[model samples]
Target chain A: MDINRLERVSDFQWKILPQGKMQVPAIIFASENLIKEMDDKVYEQVTNVAMLPGIVNASYAMPDAHWGYGFPIGGVAAFDPQQGGVISAGGVGFDISCGVRTLHTGLKPEQVIEVQDELANMLYYKIPAGVGSTGLINLNNHEMNEMLTGGARWAVEQGYGLFKDLERIEEQGCIEGAEPDQVSDHAKKRQKHEMGTLGSGNHYLEVQRVVEIFDHEIAQTFGIKLNDIKVSIHCGSRGLGHQIGTEFLKKMLVNAKEYGINLPDRELACAPIHSNLGKNYLGAMRAAINCALANREIVTHLTREAFEQIFPGIELKLLYDVSHNICKPEQHLINGVSQELYVHRKGATRAYGPGHPSLPQDFQNSGQPVLIGGTMDTASYILAGTRESMQLAYGSACHGAGRCMSRRQATRQWQGNKLIQELAHQGIQIRSPSPRGVAEEAPGAYKDVSTVVEAADQAGLARMVAKLEPMICIKG
Target chain B: MPQPRWEHFEHQADIGIRGYGTDPATAFEQAALALTGIVTGLELVKDSEMTEITCEETELELLFVDWLNALIYQMAIKKMLFSRFKINISNGILTALAWGENVDITRHQPAVEIKGATYTELGVFQTENEWVAQCVVDV
Candidate 1:
C-alpha cells in the first residue's frame, strides 16, 4: 500500500518490478487515492503470485483489489502449460465461480414501487436464503452427476428456466471438460439439498432501478434505460464448491514438493498443469463451475416465479451472467503471438473486448456486459468490455467494491437494526434472516464503488455504461 | 495454565479464529467452537445429538485444517450446529466427537455459512503452558 515501494507507470497504473523469486512483474490498476487505501497485503500477494511457475506476463490487480487468501481478492494471472504452468486451488478460491447475474424486468420503477413490499416479502419467502435453508428440490446421486455435467442446461431440462437463457450465460450455461467422477461423494452430498438456495455471507438478491447511464450507445445495447427496474442475483456453487476447494487445497499443499513447486506461501499451493492431481482438480473445479451455473439458473427461475405472481405476464429476461472466481483457458496475444493460457481470476470478472469471436452476435460491437455488484445501499454499475482490456489484464476487471473494513470492525461501528432503519429511511427496503449479517454487509464497510469504477474506466479495464441503485434487497 | 477458550482475530476480508488451551487437542476443540461461533452463538445451540469424526495428516498444521474442514462438512450435510467438542490427537490422527442440535433458523439467528478453513496465518504452536491453534476461515 506504500506508494514509495511501487513505481507509478501512470495515474491509474502502478508497477512492482520483478525481483528475488519473482518470475514476472506485478501491476495494480487503481487511482492514486484508491491505491493508497489498499492493504499492504495486496503488494505481498500480487508479488507472490508473480513467483508461480510458468506465469505469463505480469500479475495484475484490479481497482477493487483487497487482501485475500493466497492471491489478492481482485487478482489476475495467466499460466502457460507448455512452460510448466501450474493450477492452484487457492487461485480459484473456495466459492468457485461465485458471480453476479442481472435480469431485465421490462417494468418502470413506478410499476415496481406499486408492489415493492409485497414483491420483497414474496421473494424472501419463495427463494431459500440465509443459513440452514434448503430448496424444495433435492438431487439424488444420478441427478447430481447430471447437474454437475449439464450446468444451467440441466436446470432447463428440469423446468427451472427457458432454454433460450443459455445464450446470455458464460460457456452457454455449461462448460466442457467437467468430469463428475473427479468430484468426491462428500462434495456431492453437501450440494444435494443446497440447489436453488442462496448461502449466507455477502450474497443476496436485489431489485434495483437504473439511475444513470454513462454511455448511451452501450446502454441501449445492454437494454438499459433510466428508471427501468432490474433484478440481480449474487451467489455461487455453495457447499459443493467449498468442499472441493477445501479438499484440493490440502491435497495440493501436501503434494507441492512432489510437483517441484517451491511455495513462497502455503496458501499458494499448486501442481503442474499436466500432472494427474492438477487434471483431477481441473475436472472437479469445472464441475463446480457448472454447479454454480445451475444454481444461478434455478434461482433465476424462482425469481421469475415470484415476479409472475406479483405482476402477471411479466418476463424477466437475462442481461448477462458473469463469474468472478474461475480458472478459464483463454487465448490471448502474448508478444504479438496468440497463445492458449489458463487465466485465473480470483474475485475478478472477465471483460472480453469487442469483436471477440466467443461473444454473442448481438454483443460483437458492444462487447461483453460486465456486471458489478454493490452493497445493498450502494450503487451497482454495468460496464462494457474494451479492446484495451484484453491486453490490460487478460480481459479482466474488478468484481465488487472490495471490503475496506473487517466484519468485526463493521459490527462495532454500526448496529444492524439501526443500519436497516437508515436504509429504509433512504427508501431501500431490506429483508434478511439475521440482522448481524446485514450489519457485516453495511454499505459503509466497503470502499466507494464509483471511485473503483472510475479507475477501471480510466485504466481501460472496462467502460461504464449504466449505474443502478437498490430498491429492495433480500440478503442471504 | 491457560483456560480453553476461543476468540476472533481481524482479517481484511474474512474472519481469523484462534483458540488457546492447556494442550493441542483442547486447543483444536476450542478452534472448532470458534468455527461454530462464526455462524451463531454457541449458547444458542443444544448438545442433543453427537457425531464422530476422524482425519489424519502427517503435519499438525494440516491436520488442524482437516479437523475443522471435517467439522464444516458435517455441519453442512447434517444441518447441525455444534456446541461442544471432544478431541483426541495421537501421532498424526485426530478423532473427535461433536455434540449439537439441528439448525433452527428462528432460534439461532445464524449469520454466515463458513466455506472452509484456509492455511493463511495457520499455526499450531505452544507458548509457555498454552497451546494455540489459529487460521483464517472463508465465510
Candidate 2:
C-alpha cells in the first residue's frame, strides 16, 4: 500500500485532505518514517471518521495509529453536542478504560535480581489472568455500587492503597455521574468475581528498571532515579466494561435512524450527543470507568502486599494511573476561552500539562506522567504532558506501539516458545500461562514504540522523562 | 453432504468466526449459529421460547454481526438464550428472527464472554455463487 501521499505538516506531523464523503480533514502525528510504515488504508479510515456526526477539529491518528474497528486504535476525536455530535461504541472500544498504571518501587533492579523469578511467579499467581480466569475479590451489588462511585478512593478507604495514590489517578479515580442502574445485570454478573484480576490479551504485570533519564529534574521529582525498580500494571474493567460497551453500541445502532445519522462506517455507529441515547451511554461509560478504576486499585493492593512480603518495609508509591479508552468532559482553551468539550480517546492517553488543575499538588509543577508501555523486550518510557498537547490533540498522545501485524499473522511468523527463549537469552524473564498468548503478542506484531514516543516528544505533544526496561515480565 | 465447520480467525488478541455456504441465507444462519456456539452452548437453550426478532442491515455481513451481537446482547442484558433463528438475506438486505428462552443463570453456566463485534477484518465478499462476509469480535 502506498502511504507517501500524505502531506507533511512538520518532521512529526502529517495531514490527509478531505476526500469523498469527508466532512473534515484527517490529521496524523507521526514522523515521515512512521507514516511510510503505516498501512495506506489508515487514510481511508481517518477520512471515514471525519464524516461522523459531531466530529471536531480533524480526526487524529497518533504515531502508533493502526486500523481498528471504526476509528484507528490510536485515534482521537471530539464532537460538539450543540452542533450534532454523536457517541459511538466503536469509538471507545470493547474494553472500556483499558489502561496502564505505573508504580515506583524504592528498591533498585540490582537489589532484586536474585529474587526475580520468585517475584514474577508470585505476581503471576496472585494476579488472575488469561481467558476465563476467575478472581479472588467477589463483591455483591451493594459493594459493586460503592466501587462504581468511589473508584480508587473506595479502595484506599478499604486499605487497598495509600491515600496519596488517589491524587495521581485520572478523574481522581472516580468519574462523576456514574449511574449503576445504567449498567445491565449481565455487566454486573461479569464483574462479580473479576475485580482485582488482570484479564488476558496484552495485559501484563511487569517489574521494570529505569535505565535512562532524559529529564533529570522531572525524573528526580517522580522518584525515578536510574536503575530504580518499578512495577507496571496494564488491564481494565474486564467483562463489566465489555458488557456496557456492547449493550450501548447495540442501542446506539438501533437508535441511529432516529437521530438521522448516516454512518460512514457501521462500526462508527452513533447517536446524537444531546439525545437520550448519548446521555445514557455517557453515564454507563462513566460507570465502567469507575469500575475500571476500582479494579486497578485493588490490583495495586495485591502488588503492594506481594512487595511487602519480599522487602518487609518497602513502599510502592504510585506514579500515575491513566485510562486509554474513554470519552470524557474536559475544559480546553478553544478560541482563547475554556470550553467544555467531550473528548473521545480510543486507545489513546490523556496527557494533561503541568499546572493543569486536574493534576495532584505534588505534580502541579510537573505535568501528568504519560506511561508508554512497550513489548516485554523493549523499553517503556515515562513522559510528561505538554501544553502543546492541549492545543494539538485534546491533551492526548499515543498509548503504545500499536500493532503492525494481526496476531494471526504474528503467530504464523514466529513461534511463542522460541520467542520466549530468545527473550530469556537476552536477559528478560517472561512468564505466562498460555504460550499461544505469548506468540500472539510477539514484539514484531507492534510498531517501534521508541519511534512513536519520539515523534510525540519531537512534535511537542509530550516530553520524555525516564526510560524503563523489563527485569521480569508477567504476561497475561 | 455435511457443511464445513466455520473457520475461526484471530486478530491481535481477539477472535473472529467465518463461514461460507451454498448461498447468502445459509451463510447468515451459520454465522449466527456459530456466534451462539462461541458465547455459550446453544443446546441448553430450548426452542420453546422462540420469539420473533426482525432487523434490517444494509449488507449481509454487517447484518450477520448485528444479528449475532443483538442475540448476545439479549442473552447478556436480558438473560435470554436462543435455540433457533429464521434469517433471510436478499440483495444486500438482511432480516432475522430468533427463538430462545429466559435463562436461569443459577441453573445454566456460561462458557465464554464475548466483548463486542469489532470492525477488524469486517468485510463482505462474493465467492462464485455464494456471498461471504468476515468479522472479528473482541471476545
Model-by-model DockQ, in order: 0.88, 0.21
Docking class of 1: high
Interface RMSD of each: 0.6, 6.1
True contacts kept of 2: 0.25
| lDDT tens digits, residue span A1-476, model 1 | 88999999999999999999999999999999999999999999999999999999999999999999999999999999999999999999999999999999999988888888899999999999988999888999999999999999999999999898999999999999999999999999999999999889889999999999999999999999989999999999999999999999999998999988999889998898999999999999999999999999999999999999999999999999999999988999999999999999999999999999989888999999999998899999999999999999999999999999998898889888898899989989999988888988889999999999999999999999999999999998
Clashing pairs in 2: A54-A85
Identify the leading candidate in terms of DockQ. Answer: 1
RMSD (Å) per prediction:
0.7, 5.1
Q: What is the TM-score of each predicted model, taking all chains together?
A: 0.99, 0.88
Candidates' chain A TM-scores: 0.99, 0.97
Model 1, B26-88: lDDT tens per residue? 999999999988888899999999999999987899899999999999999999999999999
Q: Which regions of candidate 1 fall more than 4 Å away from where they truly are? A: none
